[model samples]
Target: MDDLQFLDIFRGKLIKLTLKTSSYVGVVQRINSNKTVLLADVVYVEKGIKVPGLKLFFGHEIVNVEFPGKTNSGDRETLGYKLEDHLLVEEFQPYRKSIRLDDDEDDEVVINFEVIDEFHGKFGSAVMHIKKQRLIGVGADAVEAFQQGRLCWLQIATKNKVYLFDILVLGAQAFKNGLSMILENKHILKVIHDCRVISACLLAQFGVRLTNVFDTQVADVMCFYSETGGFLPDRVSTLQEVVSLHLNVPSSQLSSLKMKSQLTKEERELWYKRPCPLPLLKVMALSVIHLLPLRLVLLDTLMTDYMDLVDSYLSSSYNEPGEVEHINMELASSQAVPFFAAGTMQWRHTPRLDLG
Candidate 1:
């Protein structure tokens, strides 16, 4: 509802962003103990772009969700995945140099007496300036004009007050620089501690929890969210493991591994012929891929199981009328199939076609 209320969700938890450029979005809600609902609002895509719509269906209601846009992939970028791959080997990461984590530093620059008195009552004033506090007048509105992420948001006595501040950088990297400043500061640990408290409070406020990627079982941890209980512990895997791990069983072994059926042949034939699945199915597929570990099963076994899981998840949705069906079905479609090129287009259509 209110942005301040959202702060409650982040009060005491740690925000694990894949990149410094990213800002956290999404409000946590609950329909089942198994998972928390996250609503994404105020997406930060680009000046003229908009994110696609997302929706969830309850008994007779459909809930629309908006996710905030990210400045970067955060941790994923740090890991050198995709476009960030080239950056991993570089010598100058944002963390390589000085950092500043002081609340004093984070504190508003004391407005100069002259400017403070001039703006007092008339406009309400707060300066987010990196300028000398002795200045006659300065305020958060000034800092915001430059879009300083480090400043969060500058508040004056009045919300309508306008102050002037200049941005140190032009775009996403500016946010990174701001966060890096926080990371490198000598007081970083303290700020981080504060961030944790803030995160935890936020989660509790939003009725959600912030999960540590490492604590959750996963090989290559990309992203995660915690509602009351939105997950299953991943297989104990580390970043080192994700980077180096591969299917250990020899290709010869795969011949012996029978792929399990996911959808029944009827369903499979129907899905295979489609251009793309319904969004609900896609989300379900993502849940399956993220939560299920059968990706290592022999291709044959994988195929069979995927068919079974999908069919069950789909058929069961309407089975119990008005039951408020809420399920977290998982699919291991990606790891179960080999990659191939289809004409001019290249796609990783795991047996079930891994779109994400």
Candidate 2:
């Protein structure tokens, strides 16, 4: 039987769903007309840990389904633990809190956006805020803006505040003030998704070299290889895909954001407009807001699940022998390495050892 037929049979029963990225076990609560399955009381199967909240899975995401056997109604036990255990419920509450890009909806994050233009005061304070933060999320709009001989908006996000720098209005003054110093600083950790375009633009136009970068794209590729022991050099995941996989952001929300952020020929011209549209500015801000939190989640998984690969990749980035041991200690203790240290490292092929 196909996925829909299989789900129909297993309604209200405990089953394990094998998805492309991860596995989950839960009761089939409801099946929508669109072939989407609502799973209640979900437990992340790989870690054998229960996660609070109901999870919705699309038909395309279900790779395979296995009946895990009848659920014990007396004590509500499955996999040797009570599904309603109070202690376990409290422990998994934090996992449900995810970074949201929605405007004015997320109370957990204090997202403040400022338009830095000619009238905006000196950029020194913004640089000071960045230097004070342990981690920074950097994003740019219209990656080809520099190559096309135009200006792009640059977004820098800390834990609470997001600064949207109007490069067009500020011109070279923005970089001269302090942008170049931070971008080239090797000590401050900046989480950027796919730095190739940004790196090229900065180097060519501003005469600044981006250093100490944590490329989320490369990190995702590493995580994929670790899980499957398979490497596809040609496969590069989009930002939307990565966010969905790691953060569990709903497909509908991502689809809406994607539609809003699309830069057609006409939309591309908006970047050069004197007063950039609010909708477009919001999109740019939203892009980088979740990056820092996403990095934490990815790093936690990498350090726990694939330490060897982490060691190899991180050690390759730094030259000092002592630095590697220090980083390894941090990983072992589940501490986030504040900086990438030396140079950015790409994921390289490593031979898989056969345990059997």
Candidate 3:
């Protein structure tokens, strides 16, 4: 069989590529029309370390292709290499567990919860404590409710504690107390995942703008770009997916939490209900619990591998001047220009000059 044909068979599957100088292992992303193979999540076979970005390999440069499982007579005759003999057994283990932050047995995550529903003396202290912190993980619940013109809860996680603020109960008064300042402060770093929706909700509903944001989702994309020198725009990851990838949260634990937290359309109506259940609140707490640690891990990778992009990551803010302002300014400038007579050369020349 043709080499290109063989490669096409394994597109989207994990395989090892034997080159003249070195070998690499990765999942087949695409095979270009020119016979260049693109691989994602590539790993150096000998070193057992992941190579950051997508890797492209020319068809002629490949000496042999090795995939898992038994080798048949036809494969041995056509390839002249025993697939079973050169299988990447020991070399592939590290790649499988490279992104795991912890061991399988050490899957416990502890969160210190502080529920602030009432406007009391403790509420003032909680606000003060949060304001004093330099870094906090911000997460919001009932976002679906907020989108549908209902209220939501905001959770803030520091190194020692997680504050569950009842936006439904305190309403705008919560922001007046201290939450607004904490979000708008430029000095304090807010670690949030995919801040677009939450930021919009905060701005539209409460008039609070998010500043000095270290968006974990954006950071993850940047890290991928730094490692592989490319971007996959369609591959925007969710918070749960990001946590499982970077933090190595066990699959069993994630599955259990997911099972417990799965809600139907009818169940989603509970977001507007008063006095939310303990189990549901715990589900809300999970949103921000791993954000701080996740940010730290991603930042360390960015600082070490791509120091230049670190500033870009830290400076991500939803409060920046929007595109609408720029568009309006352009419209105003265009409208200010005087129109010339249609018969004159100046009329044609003006449009050409503007184009130039």
TM-score of 2: 0.56
Q: State the lDDT of candidate 1 residue by residue for 1-356, as single tens digits.
A: 66556544542222222223433322223233323333322122222111223222232232333322233334222222111011110121121123222122432222211112112232222333321121111112111112221222111111111222111111223223332232223421210111233233323322223232111122222111111122322222321222122323222322211121233434433222111123312222211121112122222232454576677777877686566356675644554322223212232322211111
Better of 1 and 2 by lDDT: 2
* Winner by lDDT between candidate 3 and candidate 1: 3
| Predicted candidate 2 versus true structure: per-residue lDDT over 1-356, tens digit per residue | 88667657757888778999999877778788787888865767665444545789998999998877675252124544321111111121123355333242544523567666543443677778888776788987653455555556788987667788877656677788889988888888889987876887777777878889988877877676656544423345666667777776655555534664465766666566433545566666667766876787788767765577676767766766554443343332222212232334333444433211
Question: Candidates' TM-scores?
Answer: 0.15, 0.56, 0.53
CA RMSD of each candidate after superposition:
28.7, 22.8, 26.7
- Global lDDT of each model? 0.25, 0.65, 0.63
Candidate 3: which pairs clash?
A: 53-228
Rank order (by lDDT, best first): 2, 3, 1
Give the poorly placed runs of model 3, Cα more than 4 Å off.
1-110, 143-145, 256-265, 307-356
- Supply the global lDDT for candidate 3: 0.63
